[model samples]
Target: MILLQANQVARHFGGETLFQHINLEIKDKSRIALIGRNGAGKSTLLKMLAGEEEPDEGTITRTKNLSFGYLAQHTGLTSQKTVWEEVVSVFESVHAIESQMRELEKLISLESEKGNHADSNNYLEQYAALQQTFLDSNGYGIESEIKSVLHGFRFFESFYDQPVNTLSGGQKTRLALAKLLLEKPDLLILDEPTNHLDIDTLNWLEDYLQGYRGAILIVSHDRYFLDKIVTEVYELSRHQIYHYTGNYSRYLELKAAQQEQEWKAYDKQQAEIAKLEDFIARNLVRASTTKRAQSRRKKLEKMTRLDKPAGDEKSAKFLFQAERQSGRDVLAIEQAAIGYDDTVLSEPVTLHLRKQEAVALIGPNGIGKSTLLKSVTGQIPFLKGAAKLGQNVDIGYYDQEQANLTSRNTVLEELWQEHPTFPEKDIRTVLGAFLFSGEDVKKTIPLLSGGEKARVALAKLSMQKDNLLLLDEPTNHLDLDSKEVLEEALIDYDGTLLFVSHDRYFINRIATSVLELSENGSKLYHGDYDYYLEKKKEEQEVAEMTASKTEAEIPAASSAKRDFQQDKEHQRQKRSLEREIAALEEQLTNIDTHIAELQKQMEQPENLEDHEALTELNNQLTAQMEEQDAVMAEWEEKSLLYEDTY
Candidate 1:
């Protein structure tokens, strides 16, 4: 069923049409992505769909009583309640039903005491109906569900009781998202949902959204996230929206093909039109050929004209170049700790980056990825140990916050002031290459958006001819198109790179090696993000295997005498897994016995008469059932492993 539809929608701002005649459908459980360059009206279109903004022309039709939720790019939760309280508020209906259920229980008891059997039966009926509603709404599992979502967004128990008003902007945004997920709206609209998420949380969200019951209409610049979750893509460009049936990568392919076919058809039609016009002009004066010319002109006039294909929108253009090569070792950090004011974020870290190596530094937010970059650039003093630059290494840094930019200077003046010796025209040309032209060049730095500032920073960095570039979240404000442009430039850059970014797609594209920073220390993975994940998973499996062996109560005699130590290790692991499986099955059996007892209690007439006792027992039963399921799952997994090992 089509949950929502926009018919011939159009939006205008400042007498300029942002988009017109836009039509799309949000069908039941639809997974659609809206993509475009910055300023292409994606957010405006999203707002229209979300009913937060009205279209200048045409109509938006949503199903009657359809629940809608919108999460804007910077939406934050501001409340006096604690984080848990704020999130649980989304389930106000469930809470209301629960309260009514309790009230009904009291009335039912009062009527029973008064021997008003009819009144008691009516109250019991109402209470029973309300109880079913509560169950359907997941009232019993509300706390567990909230905790699952909070955990996915990297919120721990310690943060749950924190006042929502006291949280940081990012945390507030995350909390808003968590609440939205709990609400389970029929139509969920997310604008740049990946904005404040780290890689781990991004992965969790992708998994969560894939199984979301409601339709999702999202506008995001994160290609990887879009690819993972969305099955259909809508490219909003040149005052229109074009639908493409695929993920972002597949959309690129189809879009390219469609553009090529469109251009070809247009070119062929133009050629035929030109030929007919030329024939008409040459033959109209002649007696014998005049009839033919007139016929051709009539045919040409009747033919439908095709508009030119939309592609090749203005995009940022720049490149990274090195004036000189650095030594074999581009940069080295030995036993270094990075932090400020007597604080250390990481243990003594050691890393050696070679010439022309692009290394990505990744970790959770606030674990000091940015601090390490600043320490490397000498913008901040290292807390401990030595950070050394190889011979003849000239460094260029792109601050994620764009802090180094002079706020009062115009875009042109910013670049011009950096290289005063360069001609004004040349500076303007460079600015134009970065998509700053005409009036845009005159915009003061402070007035420019984050993306514009990033471009100005990039333009400046492109000119520096440095042997090493230390970037902090270089892709932060860049749109998908601009990010691709930057990725291509970096791919071709001969200089060494040591940058910190939360964009997994960008890291996968640009990084030759992965440096994982943690509280323990820095560990190097000798591959891209995918390879890093593969290695990480393998290590986890090994760790689990070792843990099972250590936790097992297996006797030494269970391992067969082996000629090789590896054989002994294998036999030992097999025996240990067998023991674990047996233990899980035994636990499952006990849980089943407990569940049976609870069921017996629930079926008792006397127990059912006591609402409070019944409710408490029901909650416990639900928890026990959930625990049993976990145990059963563990048993199945362990059984499979045992079979494979034996």
Candidate 2:
């Protein structure tokens, strides 16, 4: 059944059409992801669906008495109310019925025997109906369930009694989510719900949403979150909607295949058109075939030509020109204790960031990740120990706060001021790459959004390349599509990257090493995010097994004990080897898949016709295949180790 439908929805602002002729149907239990570039009317469309905003030209139809919840980027819960009270308010109707039922029960119990006979039936009927309604609504357990949902979202015991207004923005968002969960709407629309969440909360949300009974429409920049929760993607672009029936990963694959097919069809059609044109040009003057030529010309004129497949021509390309390579020690910190004034968060630590290495700093909120970053950057002095930057290291910083942008300057003015020698067109192109097109370029920095401001900051950084790039949450406020563009640019970049991000997909793609910050300080791991996760999981399994073995020990026969010890060692070694093999095989499979995709791109006639791109694709494929072979060798070695242990 269709839960909501928008027919010919047209929304306009200040005589400018945000979207027109927009038709959409959201069905019962449909998990849709509303995706678009920033400011492409995704939020507006969602509002229209939610009936909070009326369309200028069409009708939105929803099921009668249907409950739908919209969690905006910002929620409007009053600050005076406690978190528990705010959540409990969702069951106001059920609570009211319960109160009425309790009052009737009290009156019936206290009635006289003579009056009780006549009043008993009436009171019993009302009591029975209310009790049934309450049970059906799960009224008895509503409070417990609300508490559970709030706790799952990391709302601590101390936070439950705190006034909503006193909470930070992130805490308020969490409280709003808890309230929405308790409401149990038939349809849930969330906008960037994961922005304020820590990794643990994000994981908890994933588990919660996985089993959610209602339909969900989420707009998030977190690729991993979207992949985990959404079953379908609705991309709002160019004033139209494109549907992809799968998770983000599958959507990427299908989108690539579709683009490839479109390109092929386009090439075929162009070839036929060329052949027709050539015939007309060669035979138009011939007296014997003049009529045939005229007919051919008419057919050519009437033919509907295929438009070329659109590409992200304006996507930022990082053509970094580093001044010079840094020394072997890019950065070193010893006995480092980092944090703000009167709050030394991290314990004493020692770490090293080597030259030409990309490192990602990851941790939960309030874990001193950003503090450590600031200390390394020399923006904040470490409470203890020393931080040293290598000789002649030029650093470019991209902070989420976009502190470099001047509110009074226009985009052009900012770029021109930064790079006086750069040409106007080049500056405009760069700005366009960051989605500041036409009059948007003329807009003042003060008027720009958080995302746009961040892009501007990135654009400024791209103008002057450096050997070291220290980015703090560079992917924050960016859409998934924009994130992909950034990923590509970063992949092609030559500078060393030291950045902080919660985006696992971005970290997995770009980081050559991981720096995990915890209460114990920072620990460096020599692998990407996925590798780190695998290692952690293996460690946990080993710990669990050791605990179990210790609990089940038999302290009797020495020979039996020795044999048991030997068996346990052998089993541990076997499991370790098996895990190693599994990890290697997973890497090999991924490399093979990437190589196959590159090969497909290389085989495209359009790409092949472009000699430069074809050559690049061929080189990439060869490199990926070599990597795959290395991984396979490692896989075989681990397999052999497992066999020997067994």
lDDT of 1 by residue, 1-646 (tens): 8999999999887889989999999899999999988888888888888888999999999998999899998899989999888888888889999999999989999999999999999999999899999999889998899999999999899998999999999999998988898889998999988988888899999999999999999988888899898999988888888999989999999999998999999999999999999999999999999999999999999999999876699878878999865544568898888888988888778898866789999988888899998888777888888788876689999898898899889998898887999998899888888999889899999899888899999999998999899999999889998999999999999889999988888999999899999888799887799999999999999778666774343444245533578878889999899889778867866776677688779879998999998998999898986786677567767856776775
Q: lDDT: which candidate is best?
A: 1
lDDT of each: 0.88, 0.81
Give Cα distance to truth, residue 353, candidate 2, Å. 1.8
**Candidate with maximal TM-score:** 1
Give the lDDT of residue 50 in candidate 2: 83
Which residue pairs come into collision in candidate 1? none
Question: For candidate 2, lDDT tens digit of each residue in 476-498?
Answer: 98877778878888877766788
Q: Ten residues in a row with the worst lDDT in model 1?
A: 550-559
